[model samples]
Structures are given as C-alpha cells and as structure tokens.
Target: MRNFIFILTKEIRSYFYSPVAFVVITIFSVLIGYYFYNIFAAFSTISFQAQTDPMVASQYGVLNVTEFVIRPFFGVVSIVMLIMLPMLTMRSFAEEKKTGTIELLLTYPVKDLELVLGKFAGCMGIFAIMLSLSVPCLLLVAFFGDPEWGVIVTGYGGLFLMGGAFISLGLFMSSLTENQIIAAVLSFASLMVLYMVGSSSGFVGEKMGQFLEYVSILSHFETFARGVLDTSDITYYLLFAVFFLFLSMHSLESKRWRA
Candidate 1:
C-alpha cells in the first residue's frame, strides 16, 4: 500500500510537470462551456418561437427545461470525453519505454499490478479534477432552471465509470508502444471500435443486436443518462475496467520476459 501511494504520488507529479495535462484540461473546460452556451441558446430560441406561435407553444409546453438542457449537455460532454481522454492517457507507459526508464522502474520492489493501479489512479484523479471544472456550468443550470439533480448525479456516475474504462484501455495501449502518438492513435481507434459497435444492433438481427448493444459502452451510458441506474450497466463498466486493467498487468508482465 505504501509503495502504491508512492507510485501514485510520483505519477501525479509527472502529470503536473508536463504541459499535456494542463492543455487537455484547458481544452476540455472551454469546449464544455461552449457546449453549454449553445444548448442554452437553442433553448432560448425554442422558448421565443413558442411564444410567437400557439402550435409551437403547445408542442414545447411539455418540454421540461431541466430535461431539455441537462440531458443533451450530458450527452455532448460524454462525446467530449470520448475525444479528450486518449490525449490524457497516451503517455502513461509509452514515455517510460521511450526514455528507457521502464527497465529501471521494473527493478524496484513494486509489483506490476501496483504500478498499473498507481498510474491508473493518477490518471483518474487528474480526470476527476478536469470533470470538476464543469461544475460551474451545472451550477448555472441549477440557478436559472430546476435541473434534475438525480439525473445529473447518475450521468456523472456513468461518465466517471466510462472514463475508467477508457483509461484502462489507454494504459494497455500505452504499454504496447514506445511512441506516444502511436499509443494515442491506437487508444482512439480501439475506443472508436467499442463506441461504434453500439450502432451495429440497428443493422443486425434482433438477438445479435441485443448482444451488440450490451457489449457497447455507450449503451450502458444511455441507461445512466436516463437516470435508470441499472445494476447491469454498473457491472458492465466495472468488468470492462477490470478486464483492461488485467490485460495491462499481463502486458507489463510480458515486458519482464521480453526485457
């Protein structure tokens, strides 16, 4: 436990020492803020149109401000995460390998799983901080409109879990290559595959479609976005994260023999 903490602390410091973490954070905050502004503008436009037209007013009468704004905001944030997380995670193990420091680190008393978990925790910690930067937007929503707090809570929970899965996959990808760009590209490709697989259900037969949706990370996120909070979705994310983490540990173990 002590060793793990030391490693985690080191990894966290590394993130701050480099410009990558700061860059990613800045880009994410700006984009999310812009996204919220767009949503708010669209909502305002809709409200204005409704006031001018009785038909439009009746059609939009059932639109809850909270649901109309917050849900789509969450959806777009999820998409932003899908794009930004790879940049955040690309250098985890790749940099070590590139600098030939991985060999030195492996000689330490630390176990492979400890190293993986320490690094994983460090990345997640950074991501959580980035996610917190969006809080002011949510607060704005709460102040101007009665956003559904329950839905907001569940959506954040889903985002965090989905991020864990992305980090785990990115870590494994980083372990496979010495070039950080290659690592980032591979991670993005892998994530895209997992993401796009969800759409396959629409093209395939019913039985296979259900299976595709079940396997797709986005499908589980949909339930959370709707405030459903099903155990199956929770379990899927847990297992997805664990599976990739285990693969990362195995990948690191292979480095020992290949060294």
Candidate 2:
C-alpha cells in the first residue's frame, strides 16, 4: 500500500512537472467549453421557437432541461474525452521503456499489480480533474433551468467508469511499444472501434447484433446518460478496465523477465 502510494504520487508529479498535463487540460477545457456553448445555444433557440409558435410547442411538448441540454452535453463530453484521453495515457509505459527507465522501475521493491494500479490511479486522478470542468457547465444549466440532479450524477458516474476503461486500454497499448506516437495512435484506434462498433449491429443477424451492441462502450453509456443505473453496465466497465490493467501488468512482467 505504501509503495503504491509512492508510485502514484510520483506519477502524478511527473504529469505536472511536464507540459503534458497543462496542454491536455487546456485543450480539453477549450473543446468542452465550445461544445457546451453550442449545445446551450441550440437549446435556447429551440426554447425560443417553442415559446413563439404553438405548433412548435405542441410538436416538442415541454422541453425537459435534462433531456434537451444535460443529456446531449454528457454525450458530447464523452466524445471529447474519447479524443483527449489518449494524450494522457500514451506515455504511461512507452516513455519509461523509451528512456530505459522500465528496467530501473521494475527493479524497485514493488509488486507488478501495485505498479499498474499506481499508474492507473495517477491517470484517473488527472481524469477526475478534467471531469470537474463539467461542473461549471452543469451549474450554469442549474442557474437558468431545473435539470435532474439524479441524471447528472449518474451521467458523470458513467463517464468516470468509461474513462477508467479508456485509460486502462491505453496503458496496455503503451506497454506494447517504446514510441509514444504509436501508443497514442493505437489507443485512439482501439477506443474509436469500441465506441462505434454498435453502429454495425443493425447490419448483422440478431445474435451477432446483440453481441456487437454489448461490446460497444457507447451502448452501456447510453443507459447511464438516460439516468438509468443498471448494475450490468457498471460491471461491464469494471471488467473492461480490469481486463486491460491485467494485460498491462503482464506486459510489464514479460519485459521484466526479458530484462
């Protein structure tokens, strides 16, 4: 436990000591703020139209702030995180290997699981910080409209789980190569496939389609975005993250043995 904390703290400090964290957070904040503005702007326009036209009001009925704004905002944030998270994870193991520090790191009196967990925790800490950027956006919504707090909580919960899954997969990808660029590319490609796989479900047979949909990260997230907290979705994300962390640990183990 002590060793895990040590490594975790070290990893977090490494991120701040370098420009990576600053750059990622700045880009993410800018992108998320832009999307939030657009989404809110659209919602305002729709609300104005509904107020002006009886037909528009009748067609749309009552515009739930949660549905019209918050839910879509969560969806867009997920997409933005999908694009931004790779930059955070690309150097997890790749930089260590590239700099020949993995040999020294492996020699430390720490268990493989501890090392993996520490790094995972460090990345997650940064992700949590990044996720907090949404709070202001949500507060803005709350100031003007009544959004469902329950839905907001569940949506953020889903995002945190999904982020864990993404970071774990990225760590595994980084462990496979010494080049950060290759690691980032691989992580993005893998995440994109996982995110979009559900779209192809419609073209397939029933069982295969069901399987594809289940495999898609987006499918599980949709339930959370709808304010539905299914244990099955939570379990899927936990397993997804654990499976990749397992792979990353073993990747490091294999390299340790080779060294």
Candidate 3:
C-alpha cells in the first residue's frame, strides 16, 4: 500500500510535466462546457416555439433540462479524454523500453505486481487530474440555474468510472508495444469497440439486441445522466473498471516474462 501510494504520487507529478496533457484537458473542458452553456441557454429561452406547443418544457420537472440536455453535453468530454488517454499511457511501458528504464526499475526490489499497479495508478492519477479540471464547469451549471446537485454528482461519478475503464484499456494497450503510436492505435481501436458495444445490436436478433443494450457501458450511463441513482448502473461501471484493470495487470504480467 505504501509503495503503491508513493508510485501514484510520483506518476501524477510526472504527468504534470507533459504539456500535451494540459492542453488536451483544457481544450476538452472548455469545449464541452461552452456547448452545455449554449444548450441550456437555448433550452431555457421562452421563444415562440415554447409559447405555442413547447419543444422542451418543464425545465424543473421530470426529464429536467439540466439532466437530459446539459449533463449529456458534458458527457461528450469523456469521449475526448478517451482519445487522449492512450497517447499518455502509451508512454507507460513503451518509453521505459525505449530508454531502458524498465530494465533498471526491474533490477531493483520492486515486485512485478507493484510495478504493474504503479504504472496503472500513474495513468489513472493523470486522468484524475484531467477530470478534476472540469469541475468548475459543473460549478457554473449550478450557479446559472437550479441544477440538481445530486444528479450532477451522480453524472460526474459515471464519468469517473467511464474514465477509469478507458484508462485501464489504454494501459493494457501501451504494454503491447514499444512504439507509442501503435499503443495509441490499439487503445483507440479497443475503446471504439467499447463505445459501440451498446449500439452493435443492429446485427443481432431482437432478443439479443436488448441484451446487448443492457450490457453496454453507455446504456448504463443514461440513468445517471437522468439523475436516477440506480444500483444496477453503479454496479455495471464498477465491474467495467475492474474487468479492464485486471486485463491491464495481466498484460503487464505477460510482458514481464518476455522482458
């Protein structure tokens, strides 16, 4: 635990030195926030469209504008982060192999699990930093209108879990090659599949199509965006994170042997 925490902090500090990471997070947050602000403004306006049969009525009632409209726009930020995480994690093992640091680090008393976990923690740590920077946007939503704090909190919770799932996948892909570009490609491909997982049912039978939707990460996220704290959705996110982290650890273990 002590070593893990130490590595976590070290990894996070190292991440702060990367200018690309900062730029990506800043650009993503600003874009997503700006989009949501416009969405809310447009939705809240009492236009002729609303004066007649309202296009989007009841901002404060069920299917609240804040949850259905504004929150989902913020969710786009996660997809942007997913694309960038691989570029960052790709350097995890690949950089070590290129610079011969992995060999030196292994020569020490560090256990394989510890090293694998340290690297994973490091990736998650960096991602956490990126995610934390988006909080002020949510704060803005709160200040602009009566945003339900609970729904917003749960929505952010879903985002955090989604981030963890992608980071774990990225870390695993990074372990596959010494070339960062390959790692990035691998991560992108894997995440693309995951992103499309819920919608892939078009090729399946009707019964199985429904099943796929239930099993999909995106499907579970809808309830959270709607302010419904369903235990099933929470469990799905937790399981998704756990499964990918385990896969990442296994990838590191295999690399240890070949190294």
Candidate 4:
C-alpha cells in the first residue's frame, strides 16, 4: 500500500508538471463546451416542450433534450479520449523502457500489484481532472433549458467509467512497446473496434447480432443516456475496467522473466 502510494503520487506529479495532461484537459473543455452550445442552439428559447410555466411539464416535444443530446454527445468525447488517453498513458511504461529507467524502477522493493495500481490510479486522476473541466458547460445547459440534473450526473458518471476503461486499455498497450507511436496506434485500433462493434451488430443477422451488441461499450451507455441509471450498466463498466487493469498488471508481471 505504501509503495502504491509512492508510485501513484510520483506519476501524478509528473502529469502535473507535463503538458500532456494539461493539453487533454484544455481540449476536452473546449470540445464538450462547443457540443453543449450546439444543443442549446437547437433547442432555442423554446424548451424541449412548450413550458406554459417552469413547473409544469408539456406533452409536446422532448421531455428533456439534455439527456438526448448531451449524453450521446459524449460518443464524440469518448472517441476523443481514445485518441488522447493513449498519448498520455503510452509514456507510462514505454518511456521508462526507452530510457532504461524501467529496470531501476522495478528494483525498488515494490510488488507487481502496487506498481500496476499506482499507474492505473495516476492515469485515472489525470482523466478525472480533464473530465471535471466540463462541469461549467454541464451546469450552463440548465440555465438555457430544463436539463435533468439527475440525468447529467449519471451520464457524466458513465463518461468517467468509459475514460477509466480506455485508460487501462491504453496502459496495457503501452506496456507492449517501447515506441509510444506503436502503443498509441495499437490502443487506438482497439478502441475503434470497440466503438464500432455495437453499430455493426445491426447489419449482422439476428443470431450473432445480439452477441455483438452485448460486447459493445455503447450498449451499456444507453441506460444513462435515457436517464435510467441502470445498475447493470454500472456493473458492466466496473467489470470492464477491472478486466483491462488486470491485463495491464499481468503484462507487467510477465516482463519480469525477460532476458
């Protein structure tokens, strides 16, 4: 636990001192803000429905456009993170190996679990920082129109889970190569496949289509988008995040026997 804390703190400090994390945060803020602004424009002064009064719900158009627009709006945000997370996490182990510092770091009397958790936690911290920067835009939507606060909370939570899963996947891929570019490419390719897996399910016949849809990250995100906050979706993301983190830890353990 102490060793984990040491590495986690060190890596987080490196993120703060480095430009990668800052760049990711800046880009996410701008992009999400732009997306939220577009939603406001599309809805205009007219709320989703004709609100005779602020308290009454109208039976006309959308009950709330916030969930419909902002929740799925993160599809783009998720892909953007896929690109950006690899760039940050790629250097986690790859740069160390490139500089021959990995061996030295490994020599520290730390267990494999400690090292792996530290790296994952560090990356997740950076992700949290980047995601938090979008809070202002999330709040602003409420002013222009009646966006459900509960829906936004659950929706953003899904984004956080999505980012964590991406971070772990990137970390595992980064562990594979000394070249950051190769790591980035491998990670991005994996993410693209995951992103497309759900959409392609519709084209396939019924037999395989259900299975493919079940495998997609998008399938789980639907609950939050619709403001359901289903526990099944939450559980799936938690398990998925754990799977990639475990894979990353296993990869590091395997490297111990390298010649």
Candidate 5:
C-alpha cells in the first residue's frame, strides 16, 4: 500500500513536471466550456420559447433540463475524453522504456500489480480533475433549471469508469511501444473502434448485433446517461478496465523476464 501511494504520487508529480498535464487540462477545459456554453445557450433559448408560447410548449412537450442540456453535455464530454485521454496516458510506460528507466523502475521493491494499480490510480486522479470541469456547468444548470441530480451523479460516475477503461487500455498500448506518439495513436485508434463498434450492430444479424452492442463501450454508457444504473453496465466497465490493466501488468512481467 505504501509503495502504491509512493508510485502514484510520483506518477502524478511527473505529469505536472512536464507540460503534458497542463496542456491537456487547458485544452480540456476550453473544449468542455465551449460545449457547455453552446449547449446551455440552445437549451435556454428553447426553454424561453416554450415558456412564452404555449404552442411551442405543446409542440415540444416538456423541456427537460436533463434531457436537453446535461445529458448532451456529458455525451460531448465523453467524446472529448475519447480524444484527449490518450495524450495523458501516452507517456506512462512509453517514456520509461524510451529513457531506459524501466529497469530502474522494475528493480524497486514493488509488485507488478501494485505498480500497475499505482499508475492507474495516478492517471485516474488526473482524469478526476478533468471531469471536475463539468461541475460548474452542472451547477449553472441547477441554478437556472431543475435538473435530475440522479442523472448528473450517474453521468459523472459513468465517465470516471469509462476513463479508467480508456487509461488502462492506453497504459497497455504505451507498454507496447517506446514512442509516445505511437502510444497515443494506438490508444486513439483502439478507443475509436470500441466507441463505434455498436454502430455496426444494425447491419449484422441479431445475435452478432447483440454481441457487438455488448462489446461497445458507448452502449454501456448510454444506460448511465439515461440515469439507469444497471449493474450490468457497471460490471462491464469494471471488467473492461481490469482486463486492460491485467494486460498492462502482463506486459511488464514479460519485460521483466526479458530483462
């Protein structure tokens, strides 16, 4: 546990020591803020129209803040995360390998699982910070409109889990390459595939479609976006993260054997 904390802190510090953390955070904040402004603006316009015109209200039905604003905001945030998280994880193991520090890191009195967990935790810490950017947006919505707190809570929870899954896969990809760019590219490509895999489900047969939908990371998230906290979705994300983290540990183990 102590070693895990040490490694976790060290990884976090390393992120700050470089420009990567700052750059990613700045870009993330700008992107999320832009989306939030646009989404909220549209929602506000529609809401005003509905309130002023009974006809508009009747035509559009009830204007749900959760459905019109918060949900779509979270969805856009997820897409932004898909694009930006790779930059965070690209250097995790890749930089170590590139600088020949993997040997020194391995010699430390830490188990492979601990090392992996510590790194995962560190990345998650940064991810949590990134996700916090949404809080003010949510608060703004709450102040101006009645939004479903349950959906907001589950939406962030789902994002955190999805981010863990992305980071774990990015860690595995980083372990496979010494070049950070390659690691980032690999992570992006893999995540894109997982995100879009469900789209192909419609073209396939029923069984295959079911399988594809189940495999898609986005599909599981949709339930959370809708405020449906299904155990199956939670389990899928947990298993997704664990599977990749296990692979990352295995990758390190292989490197240890080779060393």
Candidate 6:
C-alpha cells in the first residue's frame, strides 16, 4: 500500500510538472465551453421561436433543460475525452522507456500490478482535473434552467467510466512502445474502433449486430447517458478497465524478464 502511494504520488507529480497536461486541459476547456455556448444559443433561438408560433410552442412544449443542454454537454465531453485521454496517457510508460528510466523503475521493490495501478490512478486524477474544468458550463445551464440534477450526475459518472477505460487502453498502448507518438496514435485508433463499431451493427445480421453493439464502448456509455444505470453497463466498464490494466502489468512484467 505504501509503495502504491509512492508510485501514485510520483506519477501525479510527473503529470503536473509536465506541460502536456496543462496544454490538453486548456484545449479541452476551450472546446467544451464553445460547444456548450453553441448548444445554449441554439436552444435560446428555438425557445424564442416557440414563444411566437403555436406550432413551434407545441413542438417544444416545456423545454427540458436536461435533455437540451446537459445530455449534449455530457456527450460532447465524452467525445472530447476520446481525443484528450490519449494525449494524457501516451506517456505513462513510454516516457520512462524513452528516458531509459524503466530500468531504474524496475529496480525498485514495487510490484508490476502496483505500478500499473499507481499510474492508472494518476492518469485518472489528471482526467478528473480536466473534466472538472467544464463544471462552469454545467453551472451556467443550471443557473438559467431547471435541469435534472440526478441525470446530470449519472451522465458524469458515465463519462468518468469511459475516460478510465480509455486511459487503461492508453496505458497498455504506452507500455508497448517507447515512442509517445506511436502510443498515442495506437490508442486513438483502438478507441475509435471501440467507439464506432457499434454503429455498424445495423448493417449486419441480427445476432451479430447485437453482439457488436454489446461490445461497443459507446453502447454502454449511451445507456448511462440516458440515466439508465444497468448493471451490465457498469460491469462492462469495470471489466474493460481491469482487462487493460492487467495487460499493462503483463507487459511490464515481460519487459522485466527480458531485462
């Protein structure tokens, strides 16, 4: 436990000391804030039209702020995470290897799983920081409209899970190479496939289609976004993260043997 904490603290400090985390955080905040503003502006326009026209009013009925703003906000954040997490995690082990510090790290008394968990936790902490910067957007929506807080909370939960899964995959990818670019690119490609494959399920046969959708990370995330906390979705995210973490540990362990 002490060793894990030591490793975790080391990883966290490394992230904060580096410029990559700050750059990614800035870009994410700007992009998400812009997206939220666009959504709010469109919603305001629709709301104005609804006031003047009976048809438009009927179509809109009562504006569900939760549906209009919060859901889309969460969705866009998830998409932003798809891009940002790879950058955040691309250096988990890649940098260590690139600097020839992996040998020094392995010389420590820490176990491979402990090191993996510590790195995963550190990446997760950075992810949480990046995600928190969007709180103002949510607060802005809530200030003007009555959104369902419960749904918003659940949506964030889903986003966090999705981010963790992405980080885990990125860590595994990082472990595979000393080159950060290759690790980032590989992580992005793997995440893209995991995210988009569910859409293709429609073109396949019924059974295969169901299986494909079930395997998709987006499929599970969508359910959580919709405020349905099914055990299956939670299980999928947990297992996905665990599987990759295990793979990362195995990767480091293999390297130890080679060394």
Q: List model 3 lDDT by residue over 49-90, tens digit each.
A: 455544433433343557545566656766676677777788
TM-score, every prediction: 0.96, 0.97, 0.84, 0.88, 0.97, 0.97
lDDT of 2 by residue, 1-259 (tens): 9989999999999999998998998899899899899989888898999989999899988888899989988998899889999999999999999999988998888899999999999999999999997799999999999999999999999999999999999999999999999999999999999988999999899999999999998789999999999999999999999999999999888865755
What is the C-alpha lDDT profile of model 6 across 24-56, one tens digit per residue?
Answer: 899999999999999999998998898888899
Candidates 1 and 2 compared by TM-score, better number? 2
lDDT of 4 by residue, 1-259 (tens): 9999999999999987878778877887787778767766665545533565554344334555664567756666676677788877888888888999989988889888889889999999988888888777766766655777777778788888878888888888888889988998898889878878988887899978988887787667777766687887788788888898888788888977767
- Candidates 2 and 3, the one with greater lDDT: 2
Better of 3 and 6 by TM-score: 6
Worst 10 residues of 5 by lDDT: 250-259
* Clash count, one per candidate: 0, 0, 0, 0, 0, 0
Ranking by TM-score: 2, 5, 6, 1, 4, 3
Structure candidate 6, residue pairs in collision: none
How many backbone collisions does model 4 have?
0
Task: Report how far residue 10 has shifted in candidate 3, in Å.
Answer: 1.9
Candidate 6: C-alpha RMSD to true structure equals 1.3
Model 3 lDDT, residue 62, Cα: 45
Candidate order by lDDT, decreasing, is 2, 5, 6, 1, 4, 3
lDDT: the better of candidates 2 and 4: 2
Candidate 6 displacement at residue 247 in angstroms = 0.2
* lDDT of the candidates, in the order given: 0.89, 0.93, 0.72, 0.79, 0.92, 0.90
The deviation in Å at residue 110 for candidate 4 is 0.6
Better candidate by lDDT, 1 or 3: 1
Model 4 error, position 225 (Å): 1.8
Please list all clashing residue pairs in model 2, or write none if there are none: none
